[model samples]
Target: MVKGALLAMGVLGAGMLPAFGPCLAAGLPDTPLDRARVLLVVQELEITLLTHPSATLALEAWCATHHMADRPVVVARKMTLPPADPVPGRVRADLGASATQPIRHRQVQLVCGTHVLSVADNWYVPDRLTAQMNAALDGTDAAFGHVVAPLHFSRDRLEFARLWSPWPGGGQGAGGMITPPAAIVRQRAVLRDTHGRPFSEVVETYTDQTLAFMPAVDADYAH
Candidate 1:
């Protein structure tokens, strides 16, 4: 009965802290620290997703944890790869190839209901993947990691950065500058096949949409 009630409320899974349920049911992250706290949550979530077997399911689990499992959507917008750009030096080194390598690019926006959780730029080698896998990527909304799961892949995160542009913090001296709506969490990673050859390079940016339901920080709260 209790479990059914929780499920009805859109809170599923074992990790949904009952104590934090109210916290999850609140407004967007407004203050700088509130955004930072939510970033911490999302960073941990991303770390788990990177290593998970099925990244699509991992994303769904994350959405459930944040009370967004009812309607999940990953709108994968295919993009034409230029001869240059987003092909960072690390990606080349990880792939053991130069920028000349044939790679397909796509941008994805993972939305839960009306909120956009993340936007990812994906660059993958079609040569390394099966024809069916490539077809699934072109035709489905499944994540690249899921489409390539047959490779039994592993991931190496190259970078993680916090973007605090319009809002830096209180004592940080804004100099009367206007603050932006929210912050961003950026990550760069390479996905490797079982034999440890990198087949994909992904850069995911978690936008302010992720902050849509984060809790507000208390003014007197000390970090």
Candidate 2:
């Protein structure tokens, strides 16, 4: 789970104070707020890519090529009992049983300029959302299974007035431009197994290019 403080930064509400430039670094001096802006742009692009249909199929094909196929199992048993002792010294044998392995699943989320895009799909099931994301991104096979699960994309929306408010004794000019603060965007995607256990989750915040993955989140797999 992402630190609660970071998560709190993405919440939306009235009377919420604007984040200062210093707060953007979260104590990392070298990581400037400007750098965060670039990361946000990349997140926006990622969201656009994920919404493309062709990209989705390309990702699926990539998974097929890279991942091994699930093996099948067969079972056989034999029992023998000599004449009839009370229960007879019975002999039994079993063969050809494979392990009940877990299935592979994936999820992706994108956050851009106060808008969030979420796509949740599984390798074993058809994914319409993935298809839409791929088409939007113009993605091809290059991004397939290699991208892995729990991918997150994020972007930031600027509030110019907030950036300038502290200047000149913190006074507002008669003609100063000011607008309502834009809400940060958030997207979440969860992938579940047949038993309704979530195998993967992708969560992203738009304002700071933050991505989080919680492998244990609950999911509904009924359908």
List the RMSD of every prediction in angstroms. 12.6, 22.1
What's the TM-score of every candidate structure?
0.64, 0.22
Weakest lDDT window of 10 consecutive positions for candidate 2? 87-96
Please provide, for model 2 over 1-223, each residue's C-alpha lDDT reduced to its tens digit, 9 standing for 90 to 100: 1112122223211222223112121222122332343334334434543453223332233223322123211111111212321210110001111133222223232222221222222222223235554443234222222232333322111121121221222222233321112223433333343344333333323322121110111011111
Query: Could you say which candidate leads in TM-score?
Result: 1
Candidate 1 lDDT (Cα, whole model)? Answer: 0.56
What C-alpha lDDT does candidate 2 achieve relative to the native structure?
0.26
Which candidate number maximizes lDDT?
1
* Alpha carbon deviation, residue 154, candidate 1 (Å): 0.8
Model 1: which residue pairs collide? Answer: none
Off by over 4 Å in 1: 1-57, 72-75, 79-90, 98-100, 165-183, 215-223
